[model samples]
Target: MPYDYKPYAYHRPPGLTAPEPRHKVAIVGAGPIGLAMALELAQHGVPSVIVDDNDVVSVGSRAICWSKRSLEILDRIGIGARCVEKGVTWKVGRTWHRDREVFTFDLLPEDGHKMPAFVNLQQYYVEEYLIEAAQANALIDLRFRNRVKAVEQAADHAVAVIETPDGDYRLEADWLIACDGARSPVRAMLGLDFDGELFEERFLIADIEMAADFPSERWFWFEPTFHPGQSALLHKQPDNIYRIDLQLGWNTDPEEERKPERVIPRIEKVVGHRDFRLDWVSVYTFQCRRLRNFVQGRVIFVGDSAHVVSPFGARGGNGGLGDVDALGWRLAGVVRGEAPEAALAAFDRERQFGADENILNSARSTRFMSPEDGVERLFRDAVLHLANRVDFARPMVNSGRLSRPCVYPLVAPDATGLPEVSRPGAVAPDAPLADGWLLERLGVGFTVLAIGCAAPEVPGARALALPVTPELAARYLGGAGAAVYLIRPDQVVAARWTACGVEEIAAALTASREGRT
Candidate 1:
């Protein structure tokens, strides 16, 4: 059966009758990114108003792969465990050429982390979980059918003219985060545009319901006999539904191909049976693009509003989550006056760096998938052919490069001889702490995890001391003696040092809060 779609009820806005107080933060979309931002701000004691034109979760099964880093971010916002429980976890991905198997890779080669490498949950489910989380939080004021018609950003704040069933009204906020997806109204009102390449290839993506016991693994085929001279990808999702993506060259009419008459036969050839029911179908051409800058005055952009990439790399939503992970804390701190507003420039720089990385990876995989017929096809085929026989050539296979958390380039203080896993700029890795996970103990605040020393008395930061258990010692300590590690509110490692006294800890915290190197 096709997944049932339900819309949430909309009510009259409180501001319809009279003016309301300006919000500290206003988010302009109720998608996963915007809701997560609101919840994140709420966690930091910052309340926000979330306005959206739509009143439901996603209608399509778009963006099915959630990365581990995204899961970690979700964990902080209170939906991580629920998402994991409902999602189909998979780490092994296999690639094939024609009839021969070529390469296979395991994304999660290690353990001790709270989340898996990837989880196959539909975008709608994720949004549902996020909405539930936001609704449960008292700080988030969700307004459905409240469409943002115009936006004006000033030196100190932004004002959005929103239209609702009742009437139009002005919504003022110290900062406005746009999560309005690929076609962002905020971006248009500000007269800004994305800069990057738009690919010429088209693809047919479908969700089919079947009881087949296909293992939970990503299977990609290049020039398979069932779909000769093109690429096909299959992923198992929850509820016995599978997502299949097939390449359709530039000449193919998307409308004609989307018809059930055309789609069912193509799927039948691949599955070798007519026992499946089609749930949803979409034809799309992807782009790898991003804004010139994510932070523009008092208006900020997150998720698809900030950048977009091809599905092959799973970078689309995952990249947006990265924006959420990086922006939430900085914006929260600035709103509360705990940090200078100049720190937003650092968020702009680091997230752009991450966007560039996603674009580069997605573009390369796309080129490999839809290579030109002459030398490009020859070289691609040669690589795929050689991959079957040699280990060295296997890495050349370009199934969508899976999404991973990007480590920003930060010049914060660091202690030499420490393990590189928990380096500055990277997310503080998850580990076991007695009966619970290490992250739960750290909480959502600036933290100093002191090992081999007494906990420091740093103002405005939480301090936790840990004895060197074998696992903690290996992952965090690594025989580097007693060290003090500073963690950001977003749980990123700000700095670490063996002899980081209170003065140095305060300096690292200052640099981190100020967004300086």
Candidate 2:
């Protein structure tokens, strides 16, 4: 069944009648990224006002794949379990060349983590969950139908001119996060544009309601017999909806392709049946682009406003959550006067690194999927042909790299022989403890995870000591008998040591807070 979209009620703003107090943060665009940004800030006791031009959730099953890292981030903000329960969880991906199976990969072969490797929940569901959480939080003031028309940044604050149903009003905030999407009006107001590659290839995305007994695994085909000479992808979502992406060449007319007359036959060819209801259809060109810098004075860009990638890798939405993860705690610290404004530079630095990584992968996948008729095509066909029987060539198949958390390149404390999974600059690996999960105990703050040893007291950081279980030992301790780790508020490892003193742990914590790491 198609989702019923309900409009959120909008009320008159106090700023329409009188000047309002400055907000700690003002986020434009109430999409998944913007709403999640508000909720994440609220979790740190920082209030934010979210404004958007629309009142309803997204119309289609956009951004259906949520990575494990994104799930963990959502869990911290209080919606991970709901997303997991409602989403179609899958980890295995199969890639085929013509009628032959070429490559198969498992994203998560180990256990003990709280979230699955990936979940196929629609973007609208995620937005709805975040909106509900936002409405219940006192720190989040959601202003639906309030559109940001113009933005101006001062030395200490940013101001947005918003047009609402009642009247036009000015909103002031210490920081303005433009969670507004790919065609961000806020970014346009600031006269900034993305710089990267835009491929000539086009793809058709159709969400169809079907009652099929397909496994919840990602299936991709290269020049399949059904959709001859073109690539296709299939993913299962909740509500018996299936997401189908059929690669259409650059010459195909988007308007003509989107019509039901043109879409149904193509979908019928892939599914081998005409018994499907097309729910939503969209045609998009491939793009891998980003802003040179995500932060511009007091107005910062988050999500699609900062970067965009081809949809193949599931990087667009997941990368946005990465921005929220990196920025939320730092922005909260700055708002509460706990950290200097310079701390935001780290958010800008790390997320740019992440965006570049995503763009690189997305671009590579696009090139392979829609190769030109020369060397690119020759190489792609050769790889697919060789992959059918050879183990070495199977790794060369470029269906889509899939999304994973990018480890920030931070120069921090480190120790040899400890597990690389929990090394500095990486997200702390999750493991099972006696009572619950390791991430749940991390508690959205700096943590000293001492395994197989007593935890050292560090100011402004929680200490957790545990006898090493098999999973913990494998993920955190490696071959070492004991290990100590300094975890950042975002659950990223700031430092780790086979053994460390209290003073060293305290210094690492201070450095991480100050963005020195």
Candidate 3:
């Protein structure tokens, strides 16, 4: 079934007639990142106003793969379960060289976590679900068709001149988040440009509605006979939709290649049949680029406005969600006057680290997938040839190193014998508890997780003490009898100790809250 492109109703804002009160935060995009930013802020008791030029969701099935970390962040904002139920879930991926299989990987071999490895849902459906959730939240004021025309930054606040259907209006806010996407006008208003590499390669993305018996696993072929000297990718989405990506050299014209006449025969060769209806077709050339600094004065950038990667790793959307997760609580604190404005520096620093990590990985994958003529091509071909015979070479296969949350480098308290998965600056690993789950207990605030020990009393922090289950012991208390973990508001482990006093825990909590960790 085709998705309904229902437009959101736009009403005249109060600023059209007269000046309105300053908002705590003003978001200038209604895409996934902007909508999720509003919801995440609302979760922290901060109100935000979201404006976008478009009233409808994305036109095509863009950004179909959602990572597990992204789903966890979405669950916090209230749409993860719906996306999981509606999307096709898969954890395994197979990489092939021509007709022979070279390597396969299971992203999530264990079953303790709540979200799966990856969910293949169209960008439109996720936006619809987020829009519904944002509408229900009283703290989020969503204004559709309100495009940002001009932006002015002051010493303490930023103002956006919004052009609406009725008239132009000026909206002021203490912070302006630019989630307007890859070609961000806000970034241009601030005279900022991305600094990175743009690969000279193009790929045809076609979403075809077809009924088939293919398994729900990612399939990537290198130099396949069907495509002939090019790479191809296949994935199954909901509503009998299958996404196909065929690599086209830099010389091919995008406009001519996107035509159905040019796309249908290529897809037919890959699928070996003509029983498919083309849902959406697009030809894209991607780059792994990002801004040097995500924060500039009172204005901040999130999502693609801050960074953009190739479509292969599913990093673009997921990395944007990572920015939302990292910024929401800190920005809320700064707005509420609970924390100094300097705390935002940490958000800027950490997310910059994340964006660099994403760009590095994406660039490497792009080089591997579309290598140059000489030594680069030789390396890729050698790895692929040896991958099938040698176990050591199997890990060299790089079919877009699937997106995973980047562990921020934090200088904080830590102990040696604990598991690396729950180390400082890394997200806390989920474990099954006696009742629900570990992450469920670690709400949207600072949490003191004491495993196999009593939690110490810390002001302004929730403490949870639990007996050691096998999963908890293995993940949190490796070789140690008891451990205490100080978790930040975003669920990243701030500090950990085998045994800690109340004063140590208190000091750690203060550091984490102040973004010192």
Q: Each candidate's lDDT (Cα)?
A: 0.90, 0.93, 0.94
Model 3 TM-score? Answer: 0.99
Q: Tens digit of lDDT per residue, candidate 2, span 354-434? A: 999999999999999988899999999999989878899988898989999998888988989887788788999888777
Better model by lDDT: candidate 1 vs candidate 3: 3
Give the candidates in order of TM-score, highest first: 3, 2, 1
Across 171-243, the per-residue lDDT of candidate 1 in tens digits comes to 9999999999999988999999999999999999989998898899999999899999999999999988899
lDDT score of residue 21 within candidate 3: 99
Q: Would you list the clashing residue pairs of candidate 1?
A: none
Tell me how many clashing residue pairs each candidate has: 0, 0, 0
Clashing pairs in 2: none
Cα RMSD, each candidate? 1.3, 0.9, 0.8
Query: How many residue pairs clash in model 3?
Result: 0
Model 3 weakest 10-residue run by lDDT: 508-517
lDDT of 1: 0.90
Off-target runs (Cα >4 Å) in candidate 3 are none
Pairwise TM-score winner, candidates 1 and 2: 2
**Candidate 3 residue-wise lDDT, 9-99, digit = tens:** 9999999999999999999999999999999999999999999999999999999999999999999889999999999999999999999
Model 3: colliding residue pairs: none
